[model samples]
Target: MNSPADSGAHRPTPVAVVTGSDSGIGRATAVRLAADGMDIGITWHTDEDGARRTAEEVRAHGRRAAVRHMDLTELPDAADAVDRLAQELGRIDVLVNNAGTGTATPFLDMEYATVRGVLDVDLIGPFLCGQLAARRMIRQGGGGRIVNVTSVHEHQPRVGAAPYCAAKGGLGLLTQVMALELAEHGITVNAVAPGEIATPMTGQEDEDVTSTSRPGVPLGRPGDAREVASVIAFLASEDASYVTGASWVVDGGMLRMGPQAGSHLESDAWRRP
Candidate 1:
């Protein structure tokens, strides 16, 4: 068994496969990891151009990069995607399951297909990808890291976001379970639950939702994708070897907000002018 502490051991250049790397937090995390000395495998759903841009950013950091086109909605195909990444990029030592979709429909209006689509991409997709990455890591005789990009909603419910909330909640627990099951193999699994981040998906481009006045959330402004990326990169690094089965909330203390009746006002340095 290869030990993580062995300094003389030949450390293969780390390879990280980040799904949904075409934009947003995934793309940022991929580039950040590359800058931290890891080669990157970037996966995209519809934006080949965006993935290529991310690849370019990685290369700018003097790290190897490969881009793959993958649709996370095809949950069963994730295994093949991971296999292809390992074969092409050399081997995957880190997996970031960041591909997901969100819907704002009320529960009563949510079609079965809508619910399934959310679960397939956010929950099942991560499970499949994690399994594939873990198997390859074990075979390579070294431990690896898996980071699931969940949301602050993973612990709290919101109006008109039933399916998204459910999927993310399930993902949070799945992260813990994966950690437990893969611990023997020396793999660590964790989650980064980000609050509102300035991204295309969150409608921040069209409107501002970062108001600190938004009750409950202490952070006055929306988080930057790079901020979330920083946490994900840390989790994927060797420094996080002992941290597993945990969900790091990078939500600017948003999840701690209670209802108006129970509200406790708090100030955020990130919010202070």
Candidate 2:
């Protein structure tokens, strides 16, 4: 890992807090930030070992790492977790709201409790986290970064995912609102919308995308979690200082299909589960 970024004599070494970083895109993002010279604060929902492993990887990358367990659905005050993490790490330079959940049942088949669960995890949780992080950044007297890990469904509808799509869509707009409100304080807020990434979330943890052939995807392949991390790393860097409130779609052109995707359907295949 690269050495910490030099912020001159008076500035503190940058630190980052990444939620849901036990595995997949979250883990890649934590590692990437650490390699880019930032101490890391990691949180996991149910994966204790995974979170520890992520923390170790950050330390291995020559950056300090702190681990905590955060279950958005169960937390009475989600921001409290952020506060503890920031306090433990001395300061927070960036916040990545990557933890989320989804229900695969059709909209009509979904229960109110299940829908609420998804909303709490994906939308409300990030909202609270972002607010806390912004407050800390304001108090610190320097700009910080907040990157919400929304999904491609934020822009499009999916048959089996109602709450997930709604939550992500809400987050996309929330990101813009945050950017507008936090700009004066020098805090930038943005959303990263990823398509099918080869992560544990997508059950592609053991698959190699390089050798796989996917004719359905425009890129003819699934995305690597690291690819999404690289973009997140850019947003966290000094290079993206002028960029804010934008949704960066790292879907390899999958999003290009919208109203046109239906025109090519051969039969009732799309109606199936």
Candidate 3:
């Protein structure tokens, strides 16, 4: 927890706060950033052990790692973890709003609480955390990076994920607005839209993405977590300094298959939840 301010002669290292680092894309992003020479602030909601494992990976890269519990469903309060991480890690150079939740229930059957919960975690939570990180970056007088993890659903819709799509779509636009407003401060904001990655959320944890067949997808397989992480890492790096207000799609041509998929569908199976 020692900050550079605590040691007069020590220089501050870049630090990144990645929410939901318990596993999957978040974990991969945390480790990737660490490999790029950044201290990491790792957060989890239900999987503390997984978060600890991610922290170990960061430490393995010879970087400091701070662990915190972040329940995005708790709203504005949960965002306080961002500030706490920034404080513990000295400063926040990057913030990856990777923590998110989704639902597969049909829209007509969805409950108000379920819809609200999805919005809270996938949208409002990142909104608050982004504010916290941006303010800290402004106060610290340096440019920063903010990467919101959206899904391909952010740009397209599915049969059963009504609230999930709504939240992610809203987040996609939010990222653009944030980028526009934070530009003067030299802070860049962007969104990474992933599709069918081999993550726990998709029920394919630790599976070899290449072995998994995704017939509808042009790549013929789901993407690897590391593939998504690599794009995020680039966005968080100086190479992306000129890039902001953009949604980088890392779906291995999935998004491009929309027309092809629609034309080839033979039954009403595509309409079911």
In order, candidate lDDTs are 0.82, 0.86, 0.90
Q: Least lDDT summed over 10 consecutive residues: which range in candidate 2?
A: 259-268
TM per candidate: 0.88, 0.92, 0.92
Clash totals in order: 1, 0, 0
Task: Write the residue-wise lDDT of candidate 2 on 128-181 in tens digits.
Answer: 998888888888877889999998899998887999999999999999999999
* lDDT for each residue of candidate 1 in 1-273, tens digit (9 for 90 to 100): 222233234766788999998888988898898888888898888889999999999999988988888887776975478779888988888999999899989889989999998899899888898888888999986788999999988888777888889999999999999999999988999999988787879765324444424344665556888999999988888788899999998876677663221123443443456
**Which pairs clash (backbone N, Cα, C closer than 3 Å) in model 1?**
212-220
lDDT, model 1: 0.82
Please say which candidate is ahead in TM-score: 1 or 3: 3
Greater lDDT among 1 and 3 belongs to 3
Give the Cα error of residue 244 in candidate 1, in Å. Answer: 0.5
What are the clashing pairs of model 3?
none
Best by TM-score: 2
Query: Residue 138 in candidate 3 has what lDDT?
Result: 92
Candidate 2 error regions (>4 Å): 1-4, 259-273
